[model samples]
Target chain A: MAALRRRVLEVLPDLDPAQVTDGSSLKELGANSVDRADVVTMTMDDLGISVPVREFHDVRDIGSLARLLRGHLG
Target chain B: MTTRSGVAPDGVVVTGLGVVCPTGADVDGFAAALRAGVSGIGLRPATVDGEAPGMRPRLVADLRGFDLPGRLAGLPQLPETTRRAAARVAGRSPLAIQAGVAAAVESWLAAGLHRAELPGERVGIVVAGHNLTGALAERARAGYQASPAHLPGRFALWYLDTDHVGSISQILGITGEGYTVGGASASGNVAIINAARLVAGGELDACLVVGALTALSAMEAQAFHNLGAMAGAAGADGPQQRCRPFDTRREGFVPGEAAGCLVLESAGSAARRGAEPLARVAGYAARLAGTSLPEPDLRGEVGVMTEALRRAELIPAEVDYVNAHGTGSPLGDDVEAAALRAVFGPDRPGPWINSTKALIGHCLCAAGVVEAIAAVVQMRGGFVHANPNLDESIAPDLRLVGRRAEPAEVRVAVSNGFGFGGFNTSVVLTSTTGRGRPSAARR
Candidate 1:
């Protein structure tokens, strides 16, 4: 979970690190559509995880994105 | 009352100038570089493998070490969130847009205009260029190189021409209508003329005319190469000699990229705001040959020049200088010289003529505005910058400026911006000191 949070921050350098949490909204963190795509791509490479891209369409926050990745890894 | 142009005395005038070119970033720097006859032409590294295997490096006039974020730092204060958003959006936006926005901001600042100072609904914008969305093609190419699935679904934003208008409008907080003018390389002048006419006709109070272009993609490079329009790989002679406009050994234009903006305000508005205008948009005219052949049409070029001079209410003999659209092509240079002769007639000494392309390569769409600014600079400085690379004149009848800046009193200057498909534009500019009497009273 910590690694997931770190990866999101890495992709969106403008995001306030203190504001990022499981409950923090990705949109509120200034993760625009392009930024979101970058985060997803980086996360996939870092975690060695495989999840359908469509699944990310509904993911709203770090917490939700983490759960989806965990489910794929499990 | 009517001015000599048959319009109100307080007609369209250019108040501020901004540019981001391979030569320089600011207007003053750009003009100084032009005076020194500095060349920005060089070999640009290829991002993609040569389409023609074993082709040498591409010769281009690129803005070296262009720092966008550093430029944005000079912009007016905005909310932190807004700045963050701009930064994020800029990261994904086209380089041309970024350069255009920078030029726009600088022009606005130079004009002493702020969003809070002017009514957003009254400010107008017109950005001109063809293929303004080259970044989309570049991104798509990068995506393919990375992986097919890496392409973003929202790539459509970068592919649309309107996106440029929308992005600039949003950044500038301009609520008025934004227009995009396309005319191949003549687009810059076309947009400027349109904006000036709009303001002169009372449809708008002021307008920002912007022209922007970025480095070409591999596909575009190949197309120019295929058309035999680009200088072949720099042989032992090197890239500097590749874009020698008007030189006897001239081959073709070296591709270059640039972005620039000019603030056109009605004389009344400028006076009301106590803003001293740089020059007057005295007259402009554009014509299309309605053909796609790469060959130069002397008749079309001649018509546009005569028409522009006629509109400016000046005889060809009174013109002090002409900024030629010499793209270093063998045929284009000769055709342009003949057109000047047909219009100016055979005199002992013709108007001083020179080409900026020899220094900055050919900036295509941005060439018009860039050269327009250069003409104004030369007029103000009391001298004309020579074409440093002109070893031999193709047309001995035309008095092309020599290899050094010469002292001359320029009262009026004309600039030519022509493009493929026979798109031709000519604009007449008069320095503030040499301005003629207005036939009519100010509005």
Candidate 2:
């Protein structure tokens, strides 16, 4: 979650800090397709892990994205 | 629609200008530095690549302290959407794209497109220069070497030269055609020719021609030094005196990092928006030398100048100024001098000749557009800038400006750009103040 948050903020520095919570979707947080892909790849790189592209289909929001990335650690 | 004093409602005119060079970040600031002949050349500290000493060229007119966010903030008149879009698209891009965006934004606003914009589909864009990614590649390599997955996610897009075209188009909301054009150091002029053709052909009413910043990597910089094409060891007079174009003691060119933009709009398009025309693109010509070697061609140089003047429908004598492609390279300057002699002849004191490279260093890919902006500013300001470092001229008979700025009625101006691999371009610009005739509609 922390890595994802950090990368998200880095991509959209103008995003309201308080609004970047577990409830927000990347789209709700104003990240377009390029920005979203960038955040996912950067977050995965930062964590030294890789989640397959197909597994991301079920990811719905920041919470789900963070959980999916966390599941890759096992 | 109401018309300004010297508006050309049908010709192609330069309605806006922008620059991000070692000289200045904004057009106004850039123009002031030009007239005052401020030298941006300075010695860069030498060091090794994590080991022994290196071979990079020591002298450079670097964009040392550039802060893009700060630059964007300085332009409070920029539209909110533009400011936001700029950050979103280019916030984490490479240095060259950042500089290109800064220049593009200034020109867009200066052209009054921010307030009363044309349809997005009607505005095209052209990014000039090539091999713009060596620096970015050099920087990204270490991270990739450490961990292939550790590279920045956007490195894929960032490494391409077309990023300049993509990012700027997204930020500006330009839906018209866009692409990159390259011609070694003559890249900027080639891009301008493309943009002008689009506007003149009525494919687009306005086009943005950006001179892509050329930031040489250590390898690239060393290559120029090794090739004896860049000034390396400065004499006792120091680095400032090293890049003395057209001077007797000139050695070679000094590489300067710069990005520039000129918004070329049809006079009818500009006049409809009540945009004031800074200068009309009277005529332009670009010719290629067949060889891939870096030799300067006198005949090719003279051909472009003569053709440009002829296209502008002006005789050599009517040209009030020439912004020389004088990069301080020994052979380059010599051939250009011979070309000038051929075009202007001996008897009359021809147009005031000077090299902006003497002040801002050679901006490589950005040279043409940067020098074109310098010409437009000089033509509009009614004065020619001085060659501050030229203590003795190699060609004394030519009317090159000396230590101080000289006041003159500059109406017709010709700016030259020549690149290695045989690209020679000359662009003629006439101030739209009635003294010089505006260009006719497409030929």
The candidate that wins on DockQ is 2
TM-score result, candidate 2: 0.94
Two-chain DockQ for each candidate model: 0.33, 0.51
Where does candidate 2 chain B have its weakest 10-residue lDDT segment? B1-10
Q: After superposition, which runs of candidate 1 have C-alpha atoms over 4 Å from their true positions? A: A1-14, A30-58, B1-9, B45-57, B74-88, B234-236, B434-443
Clashing pairs in 1: B1-B440, B2-B440, B3-B439
| Best candidate according to TM-score | 2
lDDT per residue as tens, model 1, B1-443: 11212333666888878888888887878888888888888886654653555464378899887777777765555445445545665645667777877787777777766534557766788878767666468757765576655444445676776666777777767776578888887888898898888778766667888887745776677788768787776456767767877778888888787888888888887786777788888788898888997778888889988888788777788788999999999889889988999989988597999998888888887888878878877887888987888888887788888898888878778899888988988998876775443333121
User: Per-residue lDDT tens digits of candidate 2, residues B182-226?
Assistant: 999989889988998888887788899999999998889888988
Q: In model 2, how large is the Cα lDDT of residue B8?
A: 34
The Cα error of candidate 2 at residue B155, in Å, is 1.2
